[model samples]
Target chain A: MNLLEWLPFIVLIPLISSGIVACLPGRFWPWAFTLLAALASAVIAALVLPEAMGSELSYPFGNWQPPIGIEYRVDAANAFVALLVAGMAALALPWAKASVDQEIPERQGAFYALFLMALAGLLGITLSGDAFNIFVFLEISSLATYAIIAHGRDRRALLAAFRYLIMGTVGATFLLIGIAFLYMMTGTLNLADMAERLPEVSDTRAVRAGLAFIIVGLGLKLALLPLHLWLPNAYTYAPHFVTVFLAGTATKVALYVMLRFIFTVFSPDYSFVVLPLSSVLMVLAVAGMFAGSWVAMFQDNIKRMLAYSSVAQVGYMVLGVSLVSAIGLTAAFLHLFNHALMKTALFMAVGCLAYRAGSLKIQSLQGCGREMPWTMTAFALAGLSIIGVPTTAGFISKWYLILAAVEAQSWWLVGLIVITSMMAVYYIWRVIEAAWMTERPEGATRLKEAPLSLLIPTWVLVALNFYFGIDTRLTVGASSAAAEALLGVPTGGLP
Target chain B: MTDNGILRIIARFLIPFIMLFGLYIQFHGEYSPGGGFQAGIVVAAGWILFALIYGLKAGLEVIPEKAMYWLAAAGALIYALTGVASVLLGGRYLDFYAFEAFFNTPQAAQQFGIITVEFGVGLTVATVVMLIYTFFVRRKSEWDEVMRGSDAE
Candidate 1:
């Protein structure tokens, strides 16, 4: 069978498997079944790498033409992300088996069902060429997300899920209104077609209004500055497995949607000139960078601190995108992929801590460095990435972002990226020192390392950080191509 | 406990013709104002009326919680099934023109394909709304705090 033909299968594999998983009895061999399904999907997605990298593809739903039929478009940008998500699924499924068993109860089948559906929704969002289609998948994932988050053992999880629901509904509403406005103006919802129409009406009040509404709507979903109120609680309070998947994928996927809209659907010129999106992004990025760092420093809970740090990292992504340079977008996208690896490793390590010590308390983890050296080693490596160490993934993102800042000739913003990242170093260092240097307390003597179930995925992610740092060609090459496609410019320096 | 007012109002005013009109919009999507997502919302709104006016217990009697979940699953299946059916028919997944040249008509296939997914969306949205309501109202006696001084009217 031709590889191009499996475009719809990428989304279908996850969705159909989710249903099959739902039917598995609570006592059934669910882990084996779910892991097999997820790994198969990852392998299928990987198999398409050559075709996807070569050019963009559009598959019309039910044989309908565009401008009416829903389409799934696979470009280098989305294909790369789809691979990351599916790869993470393949890697993390074994870990999820035991984690879900330990954290949740008899509804294991349904939980796996929702997880696959979420994977489907995320892939659908990345692949969909139609705007409203994105909303449908977004809701699919969000509704399932609420159920999954609420399934956490902690009672506070209910409140966190409820809060997420309220914010998510608001975000969805804003996105709907924005989309309605766009449809009114262009009479189209197909993104590439909309881009063609955008130029003629760039200055129209409605288009600008649509731009403002869409950006704000997406910003809320992406957890930008001041809009990030739901993130920390949702991440920290959710079960360990949920935190790993959600923290690693959700916001990054939102960022992908935002980039798709700003660069692909609207001319970069219109977005930059009319909305001054770059400047607004710059301001929010700076605010998020410092605010997230400052708030994180005082937090005693390890997960909460990491959650806040995600906000700061998101700021760097926005900062990179706002530079409005090809290098900047590339940097942002690379960082997004890199940060996912870094956070997944770190969160998984935290999950191990919780499993052994029954807490991920920084103070309590003082001597874990020696006891759980594998996990601690993973944590230290991830932490070093967070600090932008040379030959690590984070360093690559930073280097590109700094170059983009220079291209924009904005030295002060360069300082902001540097200073905020240093703040990241301080917090990451705090955890390292606590985990390794301090003495192990009496009764904290659960000197056991995590089971193979968890260690495998965490280390996979950690090793990736170093691998991608050294072999920048894949990350940089694909991101640069995506940036060029989005900007509609030949690969070159900023205008 | 009962879905009153606009639910009933809209039920009477619009629901009567919505099936026909939803079909119309679904068909006109290539030429005019609606498609899968909007149609799905419309379909969901109808089921919402059932759950609202009738207590969830009564709602469960008609559309059980487990059943609704399965129906949601079915909607996605239908959407995917259309794609597979296309493939089976010898084109690609979702390649409608492979079915018939009627699709070559200006709006025929776009309209047809859109209606297909619209039904899918309707199924999902309706199930979601009902599921959410179930979550909130499953324990009806908890409403003593709301109605105040009595467990029932």
Candidate 2:
């Protein structure tokens, strides 16, 4: 069979396994099965990525032709994101057995089942070529996410999950309404077909409203500032492993969907030039950066602080998107990948700390630098990456964003980027200071290093952060190719 | 409610017909307005009526909580497996025409595949609905006991 033939299984394997996992009797068996399923799906995504980078791979469900039946279309952009999501799932699973055992001991089968369902949903969202199919997958993932979040031991976890559900449902509704408008106008759900038909009706108010709705709806999902209230609490309160998985993948997938809609379906020309969305996005992005970073600085809980930092990082990606250039899109995609690496590693490190300390408060981590050296060092390194220090994955993304801004001749935006990087420095410094400078509390129980099961995945991601930071071949090459594919140009100009 | 003779008698008489109608809806869905979702709800409604009249314990005796969970998973598994089977038979996922060799005609194969898929959907929907109903009907004290037990762990 051709490489494209295996594309559906990237989604199907986890989807099928989730059902099986749900029925499995024992905790160990369910977890073992989920890990194997995640590994299989990741391998398929890896196999398909090389082919997808060179050319689009389309698979029609039920052997039905497109513009009619749903299709799974893989190109450089989505294929890269799919690999990140699937790869993260694989990486996170090995860490999960230890974390889930400690954090949520009941209904382990259900927990693993939901985890796989969420993974399948995210992958499905990345692969789907139909607008409606994306919505279906979005709900599938969102519903599973809410349930998983509610599994946190704290009562606040339930409240956080409920808030997310309400906000997420509203966002999904807006998205569905937007899709309905577009379908009414274009008479097709297939993204490529819609793009072809959209030009004639692009000037219509309904189409414009549809565009606005799509942006706001996806904005919520991606936790764009002002719409990001659901994120910090949800991240802070969810089971530790869940926080790691979601921090790495969920918002990044949402951003990829937004990119697909804005660039592929709506056309950059229509979205940027005709609509004047670029400036609005620029303003929002910059505001998000400052607000997110500013709020992150004051947070006492390490998880909540990182959650806010994610909002800031999201702003950087959006700022890249606002430039509407090939280089800019590359920067956005690059940050999307790099952020996943650093954030997942950071969260895993936090999970390790939580595993040992049983708390996420920064004070709880005092002297952890001496006690859990491996875990704290991993955190510090990932923290350095998030601060956009040189020779880290985070630095490469910021470099590109600066490059994109300079190309657009927006010098003030460059200053803002640097300022946010400094803000990142201070917040990270607080944790580093507490971990390294403060002495262990007198009479405190001795804390051991996190078990290798968790540390290995954390360090692997930290290693990737540095590797991608220096190598730049895979990250830069794939992102530029993805940018070119999205823009339909050899360079930065609109098609 | 269980002490009400009229309600119990009527529920017993109506449930079989309600279930039979649900099956009819399930089979006739391709050409009509109702399909798995509607049929599943209808069939589940009959069981719910039985539970409401006969008591939750009696309903548990009939279907059991554990069986409901298994059935829910089984239903989804059946649906996904149908798609996987088509892929194995050299067709794209969920392509009913993959079964043409066995069914002797494309239309027949398509019908067979749709029916099987819908049946899976129906089974899952029914069990899940019943499960939700049971949970709602279950006492809050019982739920608290379960929660307290887990928390104690």
Model 2, global lDDT: 0.93
Determine the backbone clash count of candidate 2: 0
Would you list the clashing residue pairs of candidate 1? A62-B94, A63-B94, A63-B95, A63-B96, B3-B52, B3-B53, B36-B118, B40-B122
**lDDT digits (tens) for residues A31-97 of candidate 1:** 6777777777778777765577748888887556787878888887888778778877777776776
Q: TM-score of the second chain in each model?
A: 0.64, 0.91
- Candidate RMSDs in Å, in order, are 5.5, 2.4
TM-score of predicted model 2?
0.97
TM-score of 1: 0.85
List candidate 2 segments past 4 Å from native.
A492-495, B141-153
Best by TM-score: 2
Score residue B114 of candidate 1 by CA lDDT. Answer: 57
Looking at candidate 2, what is the lDDT of residue B76? 96
Q: Assess each model's interface with DockQ, reporting 2 decimals per model.
A: 0.35, 0.90
- TM-score value, chain A, candidate 2: 0.98
iRMSD in angstroms, per model? 2.6, 0.5
